[model samples]
Target: MNASAAARHPYLSPDAPRVLAHRGLVTPDAAALGVAENSFAAVAEAHAAGVAYVESDCHLTADGAVVLFHDDDLRRVADDPRAIADVRVHELEEIMSERGGLITLAQALDAFPDVRFNLDVKAAAAAESVGRLVAPHAERVLVTSFSDARRREALAAARSAGAVRRPATSPGIDTAKRLVAARALRRTTRVRALLADLDALQLPERRGPIRVVTRGLVRDAHAAGVEVHVWTVNAEDDMERLLDLGVDGLVTDRADVALAVVNRRGTTAV
Candidate 1:
């Protein structure tokens, strides 16, 4: 599809689950793959691969600089273990990646102007900042957080600023279950109401005794106008099963492998 056509389709519209390059599609063997999770180089690599949407984590530094990174603790990506919120952006910048630079969210967006983004905000304060940074390309962006409060706050900020489109909703499953349970207290109220408000529902691959991506869950979600996107699915068999269950999207570290599987299935059918 063309860029505009692609932009109009929500990620889980059942037409085709667009491949989102998780952490920008780098493998462990690449020179820069494991250097940092959401670096500019990673995003550039995904764009070069022609993936329309890339996912990244957003965290703010002490001095209020928004950056593209996955962890609150620097240990995973930096030499130090300081909390990301405790350090200034300048201080963090001085601690270079093995490749020798830190990537700001602005830089990543600027580098790939046409590519869409899935911004997973890691902090409440970072939400408005992220909304502001991505507002110019709001149609091509979807802001999400494990925190419903943060998602609501970000959407409110974006709307107040006169952003043309409100950020899509992605409410956590835990919150949804609570809402569901509360509503069950009332007679004849449908749990689907809570599900419908969300653009997508993100739950653990398996929650408690029930599998989150079961055929039942997918049917219920689709019936309620919500889409199901499972996370961090790494195994090949698990990927196939999720596809069979009709999940709207699969988030994986191995986007290349996932895309290959999807393509192979398509060719065989043809």
Candidate 2:
């Protein structure tokens, strides 16, 4: 349930169609990869290599500064173990990786002005900050989150605070489980809410014991005007299987390989 565990088990289902480069195409097996994950350098690498969308995680610092990061704790990327929200942005600014220094959300937007971003807001309150940070480039960004409440909050903030349009709602795979948690919360309600807000559903390939990305899910999502995009797929066999199912998008660490597969298939490129 921690970030490390989540990172190890990316649930990319078979229903999605497009390829979203995870951490800008830095493979886990590589000894010396590109820039650190979620950094501006990584985003730039993805864009320069013709990736359509690059994904990044966002969290707000203690001082209300929004920045890019994946884990709640800084241990993975920094020497400290403090929660990202607990630290002031200035204090966290000292954190750096081998590729380059840490980058602000605004800096990323400025650097990749034309590239489309898949912004994953890590906290509910951070929604407003994310909205403000991305307001100027709303047309080129797609905001997503594991929390529906946070996504809605972000949408509301964007509409009220800026002229930026609400980015399409793409719920994380984990939200699907909330439907089964309580009787008061209808499963249909969750589906309908997702249908209303999202143009696509960003799901892992698997959901608990269930394979939610079956052909039926794809057909159903598409019927409701929602595209399906799976994430963090690393195997060629799995990739081929998903492609056979007519997914809308794919999120992979190997963007170049996925692009090659799609190209070799001779199917129309997304």
Candidate 3:
């Protein structure tokens, strides 16, 4: 989005070349201290490291609570065979207590009032609740999902919750794909149409073999008053390269390093 439009959305008002901590930050030291991805500790680490945004995912528990977790099951993080939907919120919290301390969507918003959240609706069941939870904090939250319908559902829920300002959002995979195709074909009209409603285009630098976040795409998105944010980028060199290409933001596991890079460049959009 343009500077003024972006400034109107508190979540995007920060200076360009933003860095979003992907699933929060878990350095070797933090991991050694029992901090886990998407855990409260991880998010706290990112916040302490001075990241403007924390990217996370949400799921619904059997008790209908919206939690900050990435996977459907606890296998990788908890070593439990049960799925998140099958467990009660209390049980899940107990399990995460040892890993890094579980954090509900409500807790995250309330505990870190100044931190902006980039939430992905990982479960359809959590969409409405996520919407409801973030409604009060719409100015500082960005709701997203791989499913456009789910994303829209959460945004609608936020609106229904009486949020005067709509939460910021990025397009889902389907819309992103169409936008990419339109960009590749050089259809300015179609590209603008695709980006009209989006605040950011969160994407990979490349999808399989085809490059997704090219300069042309970034330029087109910026021209349409949208920002482009590349995801899951971790390496320092790659972060610098992408920034040099004029991307508006980077979603990285290493917010620590990204912050350092950005500082060295003086917050310039590049």
lDDT by residue for model 3 over 1-270, one digit each (tens)?
A: 454653445678855788899999999888888889999999999988888689999999999999999999999997899999999989998999988899999999999998899999999999999999999999999999999999999999999999988999999999999998887788888988998888889999998999999888887877777888999889999998998999989898988988989888887421
Show where candidate 1 strays beyond 4 Å: 1-14, 31-34, 179-189, 267-270
Question: Candidate 2 lDDT, tens digit per residue, 152-258?
Answer: 67767777767346665577645655422321344555555556546666778876786667676676566566677888787788788898887877788777778
RMSD for all candidates, in order, please.
4.2, 7.5, 1.7
Against the true structure, candidate 3 has what lDDT?
0.90
At residue 226, give the lDDT of candidate 3: 80
Clash-forming residue pairs, model 1: none
Runs of candidate 3 exceeding 4 Å displacement: 1-8, 268-270
**What's the distance in Å from true for residue 231, model 1?**
0.4
Backbone atom clashes (below 3 Å) for every candidate: 0, 18, 3
lDDT: worst 10-residue window of model 3: 1-10
Question: Model 1, poorest ten-residue lDDT window?
Answer: 1-10
Candidates' TM-scores? 0.85, 0.82, 0.96
For candidate 1, report its TM-score: 0.85
